[model samples]
Target: MDLAALGDCLGTSSCLIFQTVGGLKIGLLMFLVASGLTLIFGVLGVINFAHGSFYMLGAYLAWQTMALTDNFYLAVLAAALGVGLFGVLFERGFMSRVYRGDVLVQILLCYAFILILDDLVIIVWGEEFLSSLGIPDAFHRPPLFVGGAIVPVFHLFIIGFSTLVAVALWLFMTRTKWGKITRAAEQNPLMVSALGINTSLLFAGIFALGSLLAGLGGALAASERSISSGMGFSVVLESFIVTVIGGMGSIGGAFVAALLIGMTRSFGAIGFPLFTDGLMFVLMCLVLVLRPQGLMGRSGG
Candidate 1:
């Protein structure tokens, strides 16, 4: 395209509005995955390298569930609850022994799991890439005109659903007794353990909850992204980037960072398409240089 055409594209009101909404949808998807990874790190003090694999598993499970049941809601629930139960088993059976263990060992263990999941996916889904899922009947309605821009309803649904998850997560973490105890244990496990509470079971539950969130994110993306072996690896890097930019262990930080990256990618594509991928790295580098602790993270964390 000529410079004149590019100028017209950039200046259009509809173009800007559509890109804005698209960016928000992208960011929220990242938030859903990052929030889970951050929570596990914040409370468990363990970096869950296998979290992405859980997401990959969720995507496949969602595909299989929808294939067998043909129920969108059931597919979503099965993907989430299935991985959550898997999380509980993983935490109790494997992760429990590695608590406060060597960082290298933890990394290696999680890395091994990643490899294992990749192989399992290949065996089940085969080497060929699964086709992109069709938008369900509910989400297949005509695009709505917003500010003179046509916006897909599915995009709007992702934004609204992610917001609801965030709010519900906040309420669960603040208003409930279980939530209070979980927070307390993160800060003072020994104290909580001394109070006659079984911290082990609590940790397992938290881990499962985090896994559930990751699975849900993947399930939601099944229709938007192609399913393939090791699909989680693609978003895993972005999720970690979001976590780092948002401040490690801060869900709100993850949300904001995801949006920042999303917006950067969207608009950056218009001006610097060649450098779009690197823009997020530039943003992350700036954050590290200016605020090492992250936007919302406390110092020394």
Candidate 2:
């Protein structure tokens, strides 16, 4: 507790360790949002500008579900499943037709979806910022102290849950039959079809998975920030930055990029209060200039 000792700690690796942990938390959330975006783009070949809207829906749904059910666990499940089902409908009824269309057209359609979704949210949620779902009251547990720092149980849950999701995704993609077929479709849709795989169903599955990730991210973020109509638009840009920096089609790339960006933004915000919002973009530009395909992306694929 001595001031001199504290100063020494702050000036050395201890400060970096704290920053890294904080950054890792941010990176985990970014991964949740960007992972879905990357998968949808990599597999379905859709720009999906409205991915952030799905995140917004998840937050709103969490608010509504918590109010109705008064159970955080149930609210999270309902939010994820509801958003995922909506994604399935969106993909099948609308995005399916534009699978192989021009990239600009896809972006236009997604942008339109964004407008429609925003209006729908206003109509349903009434354009007011809802308070944080009162997670502290809901959990009512003692804080976990890490090196004298108070850590919220909800954040611990996010870290554990995201890790589980990542592991499950890795196992599914590498060990399961459905995952193999999906990866094949990502590589060569025509070849996959020639091998007797139904690409349509596979695409639908991927879309659902992507939406599920977005929904989880939204639900988790709602615990940190009030649910608002504009939150999606604000966070989506950060998610896009993570996806681009990580690589479009590589889940591993997304994970790494998310952590890097998360740490950069966290430390940058603390060390350089000015331009905190633009730190991630600056890093993205630097990475792109050095490695156009992203940190883990395949070039000319």
Candidate 3:
């Protein structure tokens, strides 16, 4: 453990701010991805193994959208919309059947989708890395000086934007009619059905909404990271860790857990590089052992 790198990260206020802000951005981004996974499980009661594939699809779709239109906003919109549409179709065509099915059945269906989606990505984008996407000029204008620390504008935007999204999601889940209905459906699908609610469509919509979140995360991340064939796999693994730590089916838990993981990794890069990758795993294990429910999740789930 060399303290040199750690000191470099903490030696100056600006360095500390930059690292801290970066951690927030990473955490929020993780929240966006994992929220969808948790939502699907919460409402549909199925562990979607194919969620990562949808995330990968969003990146490719965004790259293609930018390549063709050269518009930043459109690229983001397209990624979310395209993946969302695909999610709807996928849920209707395949996943809907497996609702409340055997765990193995769910896993098998999702695993098959992973292979199919991976092959599709290769066929569409070629087996090469994509790095053409650039930060939008509007978002690249100028860095913000905060508390004597210069922070990238894009980083601030992400933090603020993600906060807004999280708030909006919370509002939707707690206040909206559909949101209330969704919760009802989650709590008692039989009762919801008895009340003349079409649970099948509701499930499909919930699943698509989850896909949309994952897609948006990928699109947002496109500029920061290289778009590639298997980018989603690593993200999905971290997202699973987030879900587990946050509590499965708990969106609020996911948000906080993502931040914790992000900060752990970001600072770990400076002070504990050797243990960076394993830190989250250790955290996950501890949470599992000490509080199996999660930071914000309900017990017996």
> Which prediction has more favorable TM-score, 2 or 3?
3
- Lowest summed lDDT window (length 10), candidate 1: 1-10
Clashing pairs in 2: none
TM-score of each: 0.95, 0.93, 0.95
Segments in model 3 whose C-alpha atoms lie over 4 Å from true places: 2-12
Report the C-alpha lDDT of model 3 over 1-301, residue by residue, as the tens digit: 6579888778888779978998999999999999999999889888877888888899889999999999988998999999999999999999888776888998999888898889888888888888947888898777888867778898888889888989999999999999999889878889999999988889889989999999999998886789888788888888999999999899999999999999988888888889988888999999999999999888884
- Better model by TM-score: candidate 1 vs candidate 2: 1
Candidate 2 lDDT by residue in tens digits, 99-130: 77888878888888899998898888887778
* Model 2 residue 289 distance off true place after TM-score fit, in angstroms: 1.1
> How many steric clashes does model 1 contain?
0
TM-score of 1: 0.95
> In model 2, where do residues sit more than 4 Å from their true spots?
1-17, 136-138
Candidate 2 Cα lDDT to native: 0.83
Q: Which pairs of residues have clashing backbones in candidate 3? A: none
At residue 249, candidate 2 shows an lDDT of 82
For residues 1-301, what per-residue lDDT tens digits would candidate 1 score against the true structure? 1445446657998878988898898999888989999999888888898999999888888889989888877888899999999999989988889987998889998999999999998998898888655567898789999888889999998899999999999898899998899889878889999999999989998899999999999999887788988898878899989988999888889989999998888777776678888989999999999999899887884
